[model samples]
Target: MKKLILISGTMGAGKSTVSSELKNILPCNVFLDGDWCWDMQPFTVTEETKEMVHDNIAHILNNFIKCSEYENIIFCWVMHEQSIIDEVLSRLDTSGTSVKVFSLIVNEKALTDRLFEDVKKGIRTEDIIKRSIERIPLYQNLDTIKIDASNISAKEAAQLIKDKLK
Candidate 1:
């Protein structure tokens, strides 16, 4: 059976970085970052755009799942809510897939430091720090494996996730 790995975390929690490393270590794998679906100018967050992004992600993931060339489908995004995860899963044909969900948990200080570094480098604006920090506790309530990423490197985090699969 193929594996469908869903990686979730607050912004700046290294979801993209870890997922990238995971794709490298996994055989016949494809990585999909949710942000890529929402890469629109003006970055709108209206209900319509949210729906469109979800549909687009589901479409891409479903196509990947149907492809026999890939044995592992790795997806990462800021999936802070159960409904979002459900919505995406509901749209996919995962009949023969073993699905695993993971949330990258980070300490407040560590998250703040990471976001601040991104801000300093102009990768992200300073306003994103508080918003990202506020979503930290939300992951605790999620029904998924939690990886403590406060002190670990992205490669280490990916290794931990890969170990969990075995």
Candidate 2:
């Protein structure tokens, strides 16, 4: 059976970086970032757009899951709530696929430091720091495997996740 690895965390939690690294380590694997579904100009956040993006993600992921060329499908997103996870999963045809959910947890200090660097580099805005930091505690309530990423590099985090798959 194939594996569907769902990685979630707050912004700046290294979900993209770790997912990329995991892709490099895994053979016949494909990685999808949920943000790609919402990469639009004006970046609207209305209910319709949210529903559309979720549908887009599910559509792409289902294709990947059904493809014979890929054995592992890795998806990462800022799934801050269980409802979001459930919504995405509910749309997927996961038969014959082992689904694993992971949340990358980080301490406030670490999260702040990371986001601040992104701000410094202009990768993210200043307002994002506070909003992202505020969501740190939210991951604690999620019913998924939590990986404390305060001090680990993306490679290490990916390794830890890969080890857990065994």
Candidate 3:
């Protein structure tokens, strides 16, 4: 059986960074970022877009699960709610796949610092800080594993996930 690893967090919680590092550490692994499915220029957050994005993510994930070239699959997204997670998971064919989900949490200061750096790099706008922070609490109390990502590099976080999977 293959492994399916899903990493979820807020906008500045290093989900993409750690997901990339995990790909580097794992041999024969396929990595996918959920943002790639929702890369609309105007970026509207309607229910229709949400459903479409989830469908797209599920389709890609099912493909990855069926592919034999990859022993492990990694995906990163800002999944703040359990219902969203459930919906995505329900769409996957996991008959021979072991799925693991991790949620990254950071201190408020660390999150703000990361968001500021993202803004400086032109990857994120300043208003994203407020929006990201507002969803932090919603990420907790879920069924997924939670990791404190306050003072770790992406490589370190990936190593932690690799260790946990072992």
TM-scores of the candidates in the order shown: 0.98, 0.99, 0.97
- 1 or 3: which has the higher TM-score? 1
Report the lDDT tens digits of candidate 2 across residue range 6-122: 999999999999999999998899999999998999999999999899999999999999999999999999999999999999999999999999999999999999999999999
| TM-score ranking, high to low | 2, 1, 3
Which 10-residue window in model 3 sums to the lowest lDDT? 134-143
Query: Against the unseen true structure, what C-alpha lDDT does each candidate score?
Result: 0.96, 0.95, 0.92
Off by over 4 Å in 3: none
Candidate 3, pairs of clashing residues: none
Task: Arrange candidates, best lDDT first.
Answer: 1, 2, 3
Candidate 3's TM-score reads 0.97
Please give, for residues 41-100, the per-residue lDDT of candidate 1 as tens digits.
999999999999999999999999999999999999999999988989999999999999
Q: Which residue window of length 10 is worst by lDDT in model 2?
A: 157-166
